[model samples]
Target chain A: MNTTSWLNPLAALVLSPLLPGIINRTKAFFAGRRGQPLLQGYYDIAKLLHKGAVYSRTTSWIFRAGPVVGLAAVLMALVLLPLGGSAAPLNFTGDIILLAYLLGLMRFFTVIAALDTGSAFEGMGASREVQFSVLTEPALLLSLAAMGKAGQIGSGSRIEHLDNFLSLSGIYSNLSASVWMRNGTILLLVAGALLIVLLAESPRIPVDDPNTHLELTMIHEVMVLDHGGPDFAMILYGAALKLWVFSALLAGVLIPVRSAYWWLDAGAVIGGIFLLAVVIGVIESSMARLRLLRVPQLLTGAGVLSILAFALILWR
Target chain B: MTGLTGSDVQGHLAVAVSPLRSVVLISGILLVLIALLAVMRSRLLAGRKVELSGTWDCGYARPTARMQYTASSFAQPLTNMFGVLLQTHRSLERPEGFFPTQAGLHTETGDIFRRNVYRPIFQSVERLLLWLHWLQQGRVQIYILYIAVTMLILLIWNL
Candidate 1:
């Protein structure tokens, strides 16, 4: 039993909320203002938990179930992902596909909850979220596939082990110093695509401004406008975890720092995650959100990058 | 033949499969966590009285739903960018004079292909059918004359 593999999810649970706090702090520093405490998200979640939930008369159980199912689905996905160099605690050959679709299931529930409110703003947010996610999902999966091809060139030919094509470990399992030197372009393109996917999926600046209060321009925020109290806490925590998962995936790809010492590798992966949050914070501080029409263009550009990466890997 | 991600077996048909024991363990932990949160929330809310009130309007007494942005208006920028393709049809009742009553606007984003493509084809077909209405005229005399002409042509051909 690979007992140490459990550290991935435990670390993810304990440290995920710190990510948004760091991003907020970085943004505040750039703006020359004292930010909220680094534990502000944790405080907010605690406060929200103590409050009473207010449900709309128009909503049913599905509205209440949205946060529950979304958080659960994301947790399920976390078990499939390998945050460190080792395999996920629940790793399987095709766990990668399960991870991708589990996220889609989460989005599905969120959209359904938005429509349940029957509010114009929530509906609009739902429409935009689904449409943008349609583009981002392909970019994400294709980029992962391209990166997985890097792992295929281990001790043997990839053609021999074709059945293991969908394993998430295939993205990083066989990363050697020589592989990166030989196929650096493919790695670069895949990283670019994954970066776009991370930003779009996590409601980062270029795709969405999570701090925006203008309902007309909101995407993920407006959808949850009506959810209050404990339900809202669940949603907030779920968002942080979602951000953590994407950040972890991107960091694992960018920083392929594997070691025989499991603790050292886990420490590096965690450090890489925090570094990614700082990079995201700098990016948000630097750029404005894209115009709504321009969003599809950016997503399509990511898709093009993924395709290029895939083609490069296939050629070799 | 192997599946897209390949099969777990050498010759059998099962796809790439793994029993997610970790997921089962995680799910149990998560369920317990959720239950704890629910209990904590209930404990906090127990016997706590709350009141519902109208939304604060920031000193505006005439607070109304109309003040909020409508669905179409909220998505105006996106719809406008795709307006040529979406073919959004809007009917506006512009406010006439000062303080005009009954001023309103309606926007319909119907299918572009149905409105622009099918409508013209359907209208032309209806026009052609109207023109062909003369063939089934309800006059016996004209019908007899048409039959006579047909009989004469056949008789002449036979000769």
Candidate 2:
């Protein structure tokens, strides 16, 4: 458990930037173009950190606190998450709920900061972000609940108990009924929902275009328009950390190889992370940014699918 | 004790009826007074005859309501921009060329909260709970009829 706990944050920090890089590389490979270095994001963050930050005259203290709080929240959630089926350092009842709420808190502050700029473009982005999250939240929780229930895990249990592959396999094997069948179905459903959520939340392609300079069509990027220097670095790192944590969680649920061997589990987790990034890159490279009006339909479809998962669990 | 109980029931009934009876009586008297005053004022005005003359059109004989700006026209541009989210429906009819027989336009926008948020959720829930739809149809009417029947039963028992 301690080995897993130590490895989780270390892995999150090391692999966070690489995930985006890998996605871009995958997309580039598909297009038959030379891809950027895997460490390109690291270089970008270093450049941003060295540069001086420009403060917006229209902004208040919240703009300053937004990145700090955002980074802190994601780090805290990573601490709560188990890497390769190991319990996190801080495990408590309802910790997963706390993790989700902490992420929500970060988003709440970030959105407020966006609005504080008094930019109509930022305000529009914030409005759409909040509106979409309202629908996304239920799907997220419902899917998690379905997975937990299918595994015969109690809702109030700490996430730490499910950290590594060994424990997951132990729990999976010891169940009186067939847990893997239900777990596999729930995993697929959750993975699908989380895939969409990752795209939306991370401001990836289809839901948002990170590379786009136009603020009007931007989601996450537009919200951070006024941020610079260390603040911008923090936002970038925080987003990467968030993507890493969610991907790790999805990997834990889907991957079956869990033993006392930390190296194997870590490799599986990293491989899962890479696979997720490739999928994201493929999605971004292939799909055009959805019409703003149609984005809600995509989110609603995710919500409907998650609800069906919940209903299936209840019915069974 | 029995005699006192009978008087108490009568007293309670009076307590309920007295305020309503007084309110009706006072309003009836006020209505009559208002009618009488109106009749007296008209008669007094009729007795005094005065004649005055001025330009009926206030020196602008070409004035028309068509020349005035309307509130809807002022808000047309903004409403058009957000038409999708606002669910604004518009219909316009115009005659070709310079001379037009009739030209009219109408616009109606749905409630923002209902169209964007509430209706979608409601539809989702309805789809999830299709069996419960019958229970909600004419629900308010059924509730009112149920209340009326209960009141009638109470009234008969009291009588």
Candidate 3:
């Protein structure tokens, strides 16, 4: 509600592209090669925006609508997020559910658009996408629910009057060092679940290989193979923003720096996010992508962790 | 459309409606506007060198719709997951020998409820109804005798 709350979405819009750049640089560092510039993501988007698009004859308006609608959904998710040490610009009880479903909406459009292409490769990608999301979504929601429960415990009687006490802003803002100290195990479990969800949702290593050339092996990237020019730019930027959004959620839990100064809180959260991205980069460098059959098991493991966390909170 | 106007309803209504007002509506408008922006940006910056071509199929000069992913293939993963419940029957004939003659894979998924539940019940109903087939006999005398017997029974009961 405060004027400073605008900083969260603004920061996300401006700096999201950097997270991917940082991750790429980290991977390059591990590979013993000088990486592209940190602003490479921005450059790609700019170049893409400067080019013309080619539409498949098989595609309809849904193909065109995918990137724009997806970007919009991510933007909506970003606005609902509480970052730095403040509430989100738009926060209400049950906004957590909205945040999750907004991502779902984005994915729905992307899948349908891929299907609209009527390409076998894109269809393969879409199948893998929906298949993985079947596991990923439950993990995400359960993890968020766990965090909400932990937040409820932290806020105690204050949120009792509300119909649903699990707003993203409320949960993030309620997270503090003391709460972490008290519920360290639950938070740890939830954080692990969230990290897996982040990697899976963002199409990172282990769950998927973003750089895979074989369409049979790829998931997210293959879905957009037919998109080019400004549409591709939107997709790319939307992806970066999604990674940023998930990173922010994870960082919020990992770094509970709730300070009086908004700048300090924002700085810590953003720093935590960059660190998480570096972690992801290092992970990609060290680990091979999981076998397609194994991805579901990994996602199911995350769900188990979240379920465990929720159980811990419930019984406690 | 009905409106909630009273002050008592305002607080709860506003709280519930804010997400629709702020997130959903804004996102919808933004989707259209940004899509238009993308179109215009591409137009302005592309400098009119746009090209249309077939989707890259690994440079196979000739590609047909038959080779494209079918709806069934698209749903293959999900169907495979629920195969036991769906009862998707599949048959594969792999080509043999140096010069392969024929290869085909056919999959059929039928309605589980109809196959497992409804069909048996309907079959039993048909068999039970078949027992009454002898009543029709294809004869006018049989119908007259049946009517006379019904009339005699009715008179006896009345007496």
DockQ of each: 0.11, 0.01, 0.37
Off by over 4 Å in 3: B1-47, B97-101, B111-159
Measured with C-alpha atoms, the lDDT of residue A39 in candidate 2 is 90
Q: Which is the leading candidate under TM-score?
A: 3
Per-residue CA lDDT of candidate 1, range B1-159, in tens? 435443345333433223355345655765775566556556766776433433322345654455544567656756765788898889999989887887888988998788789999999999999999988889999999999999999999999
**lDDT per residue, candidate 2, A134-224, as tens digits?**
7677877776666665555423244354321122222322222234554456557766887777777777878888888777787888788
User: What level of docking quality does candidate 1 show?
Assistant: incorrect
CAPRI category for model 2: incorrect
Q: Top DockQ: which candidate number?
A: 3
Model 1 clashing residue pairs (backbone): A163-B6
Q: Which ten residues in a row have the lowest lDDT in candidate 1 chain B?
A: B10-19
Best-to-worst lDDT order = 3, 1, 2
lDDT of 3 by residue, A1-316 (tens): 7888888788888999998899999999999989999999999999987787788777887887888788888888887888855888878777887888889999999999998887778888898899888888888888888887787787675757453356788777778888788889999999999999999999899998887888778899899999998889989999999999999999999998877777998899989999999999999999999999888889889999999998899899
Name the best candidate (by lDDT): 3
Output the worst ten-in-a-row residue range by lDDT, candidate 3 chain B.
B41-50
Candidate 2 docking DockQ: 0.01
